[model samples]
Target chain A: MSGILHIAGLGPGDDALVTPEVTEALAQATDVIGYIPYVARVAPRDGLTLHPSDNRVELDRATHALQLAQAGARVVVVSSGDPGVFAMASAVFEAVEREPAFESVDIRVLPGITAMLAAAARLGAPLGHDFCAINLSDNLKPWAMVEHRLRMAARADFAMAFYNPRSKSRPHQFAEALDILRAECGPDRLITFARAVTTPEEAFNTVTLGEATPEMADMRTVVIVGNSATRRVGRYVYTPRSAV
Target chain B: MSGILHIAGLGPGDDALVTPEVTEALAQATDVIGYIPYVARVAPRDGLTLHPSDNRVELDRATHALQLAQAGARVVVVSSGDPGVFAMASAVFEAVEREPAFESVDIRVLPGITAMLAAAARLGAPLGHDFCAINLSDNLKPWAMVEHRLRMAARADFAMAFYNPRSKSRPHQFAEALDILRAECGPDRLITFARAVTTPEEAFNTVTLGEATPEMADMRTVVIVGNSATRRVGRYVYTPRSAV
Candidate 1:
């Protein structure tokens, strides 16, 4: 029997948001692998085995999924958001590159509703204009690079979305990010902090760059900074389609 | 009877990619309003009325939807991709801002698998790292601003996604944009043109910056330019998650 490896996105912690393509992949998988919380999102079945690992072990997890697929096990690697966006898809490809034998494995990346878009939907189109999505973790890239991108994005007048904005390990960096934004985007720019979007724990807050504090964001939060044209319309905040 | 408005995404033209949330919204919609093609995607039913309008009339269509909703009609405004991403969600809010009487209208924006994300999935994660999405259409924004954002995005080394890269009215501008991209991103950079993604007529081509021409893209295409680290892994193109 030929085995397949599918890197699937569970889509911001909502069952309704998960695409039928991904749901169909999960139903057909013999083994499901992912970070603990994501893997736990999958229901246990008679023939399916779940392999949940700790965070930051993405490479190892990808390798294991590849090995399982090589052994004729239909494997699915899951990520919280779209696997292609700061998630499992690239890691799987990196593994395939490291081991050329895995290159021939049937791999497909399934897209889903990413956090930034989900947050934007809830906040009334804060990213409705030109935008950029930056992963602010600083684990993979330097803090300097993030700051540089932030400044460039501001100068370009693009609305921005930040993933992994603040964590216990990197407490001070988000503050630094906020400082950079205040300097570049100025005090009046609107910013939205959407925590645990689309789930029961979902919370949304929109504030100005001057009013925003780093503590408002956590690891679960996705922060959006609007372009110069973004503003409040009734209870919602949105950037106009036209630019100045 | 209270009225409601839902701005929903149809997910890059695939039945399977459309989320259950969006499907449920369609089922309950008393009227569906959008550009011709998008409105045609919704099936005809006894209670549902489809209002198809021509392109470049976003504001007019949005106001009509608001009017219908205010008249106690459940309206769903459809966009081909996520409504919040260069689509109808912001247009709807812009209408709301213009008329304060519509403030009481209940509005919700449902997310969908946007063209860029769907294209990235098919291309094996070209946007696996930091990225920006720009609408190259000069209809709303000035060409100089588009050029400036291209330079800034290239300088920041973010993977880039272009929406409405070329249209019959503005043919030469995309060539100029490509010229700027080549100058900023270098000749060796990789670019992918994904036409009609997730649809039956889907076509994907990955070429170097030197080889890409303006004709590779049209209104239906979503263009992706990879970061410096992006390279070929087997038949796929992907950017590694890590930065230098």
Candidate 2:
């Protein structure tokens, strides 16, 4: 018997942001797998077992889910935001590539409101124009590549969203990123730090590239740098639809 | 008493993909405003006035919503996908900027599953790495700017999602885009055209830049151009987490 393995996004932290498709998938799953915090969001039930793992072990978690589904345990791998955006969907796909026997497993990637969009909603459409989303963490890619990409994005005048901007270990990289942005985007360009968005702890600070500090961001923040035309309308920050 | 204005996203087209927050907003709305198709998605109920307008009248629609809210109407302006991403949120903010009197109106932007993320989920994590979303329509921006941004994104090796790829008025631009992409990213690079995503009409096609044609895309299609590291892993396309 073939069982399904669903990679689902739980949105940011709010249950109201969760899609009914994901809710239905959770209800049908026999097992839920993910990082500790994400799996913790799923309600435990009589037939469903939750497997919560730590960070940096995405491959292991994905493999476990694949193996369980292959053995007829219906599984769902949870990610905080959209599974395809630097989340579990890619990890599961990578696991499938590693083992040819896992190719036949039924896998579906369900989308959700990612942190950047959620923050953008609360901050008022900073990404209302052409934009780029870059993962600022150097754990996967080279630091130089990040710099190069940031420069390219700035030169293109694309609004930017950055994930994993500042973690304790890579704290200095975000500072360097800020320096690079100050150089490329100018001091007056808008930058917003949105933390724990859509949660009870949700907080936002909108400042210019000149006013922005590295300390404003942490691991839980999603940073948005507006394009050349982005500005404040009343209390909200948004990039106008039409280009100048 | 003050009425609230909720700018919400209805997700792609699936009722199941709509977020609970958006659903709740609709249930509380006394007036719903949006383009004809999007307004049609909302269920018509007693005491709710559905104002379906035509496209390209975004500013007018936004102004109407604001006026209604100022008059103490519980207004909900709907957009397909996330309102913050090239949608109604920016337009509303633009309207607010135009009319200083509308400033005191209570407004909130709610997030939804944007088309790119939904398409990426269905296509198996094509945007698993750093990516950009660009509006290809030259209705707002100059043609040269679009070309320049495309070149920059290609240089950055950023995966890309393009909205409003083609319409009858500007079919030639997408053809020009393909030529530029072929020159910059080369013919062998992968591109996926996903149309009417998350709906009964949803369809997908994954082709290399060499094999692609302008006819593959339309206004309804969201095109994804993979990064250099993106490749096929079994039936799915993914960019690996670890950068080489």
Candidate 3:
């Protein structure tokens, strides 16, 4: 039996936000692998094995999926948002690069509604203009690099979306990020914190850079720093199509 | 009859890519409004009126939707990709900001798979790292702003996704933009042109910055320029998770 691996995105926390393609992939999968929460999202049924791994063990998880697929298990690697964005697609490809034998494995990356887009939709179109998406987790990269990108994005007047901000292990970094934004984008620029987006526990708050506090965000939050042109229209915040 | 407006994304021409939320919005819509092509994507139904307008009249179309919604019609404004990204969501909000009488209209922006993410998934995560999305059309913004942002994104070593990169009226601008990218990112940088992504006529091609010509892209294409760490693994091009 030939095996294929599908790296699929579950799309934020909403079932309605998930694409039909991902649904079809999950339906056809004999094995599903991902973080505990993501794997738990898949319904359990006969002939399907679920493998839920711990966080930060992405490489090991990817390798396990690869091995399972090689053994003729139709595997689907699940991610909360778009698999390509700071998620499992990169990890799977990284594994393939390290293991030449897995290079020939049939792999497909499915796209989904990323957290930033979902958060942006909840708060109006804050990313309507040019924007940048940065994974603020310092696990794979340096804080200095994040700072540099934030400065450059601000200078370019691009709205910014930050993922994995203000985790319990790295709470102070988000404060530093806020400081950099205040310095580069000024205090009045709109900043949005969307926690548990598209879920039942979802909460959205919009504040200016000066009014924002690091305590307002957590690992579950996706932060959106609006461009210079972003402002409130009635109760909604949106960046205009034209440049400031 | 309370009026409402739903700005929805059709997700790059694939019916499978259209989220259930957006599909439900379309189904409940009393009137579907957008550019001729996007409106054509929505099926014609007995109660739903299709208002297909010409291109470049986003504000007028937005106004029409607002007016219809104010008249107690359930209006759905459709865009090809995510409405928040260089699409109609901002236009509708801009109209809201301009006309206070329509401020009470209940409007919700539903997210979908943006072209860049779809293209990145197809090309195996070229935007796996930090990235910027810019609309290279110079229709609303000046060419200088696009050039400046391009330089900044390159200097920050961010992967870049460009929307509306070329058109018949501004053919030379894309060539000029390519030259800027070549200068800032160096000639060896990988660039992917994904045209009509996720559609039946979809096409994808990857080339080095030095080899990419302006003619390779058109209005339908979403162009992705890889970061310094981006490279080919087998037939796929992906930006590494770790910074170099």
Candidate 4:
């Protein structure tokens, strides 16, 4: 029996961007496994088993995919955006190490459109230069570490793409985080709000740090805070021509 | 006759990654115009009028594309990798402003796989977060500006993607740039080199700043300097986990 593990990228939002490679991988898979929402993006088909669960339960899904792969089934572990960027790739690797049975399994991760690229494309290239991505979600890590990195990026004048900026349970966290960035970088910095990027309901708004104030963002929004060089041109916001 | 300008993305290196969207646009184009090399990437198709020119002559190509659009020809302005990132999109806008006759023409810039993303995918996720792209070619800019931004990115610990890092005549420039980064970001800062990524002769190598000298890179190489938080795992290098 032959077993291969394919990690597919579901793109940022729209299904149209799902590459031919991803669609081909999905078609050949005996088991399609991913975070619940990611799994739902593909159509249900015959001879395919769907394994869906919460995003936090990555280890469980990896183990399940490993088990399926080891059973001589072509298993595909899917993730929204790119599989390698904070997605199923690491968990799959971790599972491979823990389970010697899957050590030699053929694994390849197909690149997808990451949310950072999607958000940047919508905001007129706020990511034109050096930047950093930081997740404000404290569910798995400490807020102190996140804060330290944010401050460092601000001081370095790196543009920032903030993920998990806010959720209902932690609604005020983004505002507090904005305050911290404003204190370190100054209030004149540019903040861009990209909501439902690449989706039909896409909306964009750019403002100063003083105007951002948490109210402009939501859980679904990707917040991009421009560095010192970022500027407004007509309706679009972008980093000005680099002196370099 | 509706005049249309299609800015098509020729994916990084390999022609297969050229999405169906790009192929479709190319098929419909009557005038295929862009930089000489980019124009050469497409096969000699019947009924396609080709307009190719020098690298520094971007405005010239955009001007010609706009003229073709004004003449009611279906024009496809080509750019290697993505149209938006340091490519034809900006030039198209510039041409639109310079010649008001083409202002009413509908323009579309279809996204292509950027070299940064292609290189990142091949060398793990150095750009897994916010990052900046800086062109090291000093044809239109001064070296002082490049050094300043490099110093800032190094000090602030931003992941950096470098374009035109080195060439035959100006080979020592990339070395000097690396020296500044090494001084500010330590000799052990992780650096990933991607040459002709997604092409038949694709090459990937990861080394520390101490190991990266000017000789290691050339015009075709896209260099990535991982931030302070980037770490090495065996042969792969990656930034801190990005969650969105």
The parts of candidate 2 lying over 4 Å away from their true place are none
lDDT string, candidate 4, A66-115, tens digits: 78887789888888877766567766666665566666676666677667
Question: A201 in model 1: Cα distance from truth in Å?
Answer: 0.9
Model 1, which residues run further than 4 Å from truth? none
Each prediction's DockQ against the real complex: 0.93, 0.92, 0.91, 0.29
Better of 2 and 3 by DockQ: 2
Candidate 1: C-alpha RMSD to true structure equals 0.8
lDDT of each: 0.95, 0.94, 0.94, 0.74
Better-scoring candidate (DockQ), 1 or 2: 1
lDDT of 3 by residue, A62-131 (tens): 9999999888889999999999999999989899999989987889998999999999998999999999
Clashing pairs in 1: none
Writing each residue's lDDT as its tens digit, candidate 2 over B196-225 gives: 998999999999999999999988999999
DockQ, model 3, C-alpha based: 0.91
Q: Write the per-residue lDDT of candidate 4 for residues B1-244, one digit (tens) a residue.
A: 6778887778676764566667888988999988887889988878988988888777788788877787789999998877766676666665665566666776766666778777876665566543567778776567776787687666545578888899887877888898898889888888888899888778887889998878778778899988776765444455654322
Report lDDT (Cα) of residue A69, candidate 1: 96
- Output the better candidate (2/4) by DockQ: 2
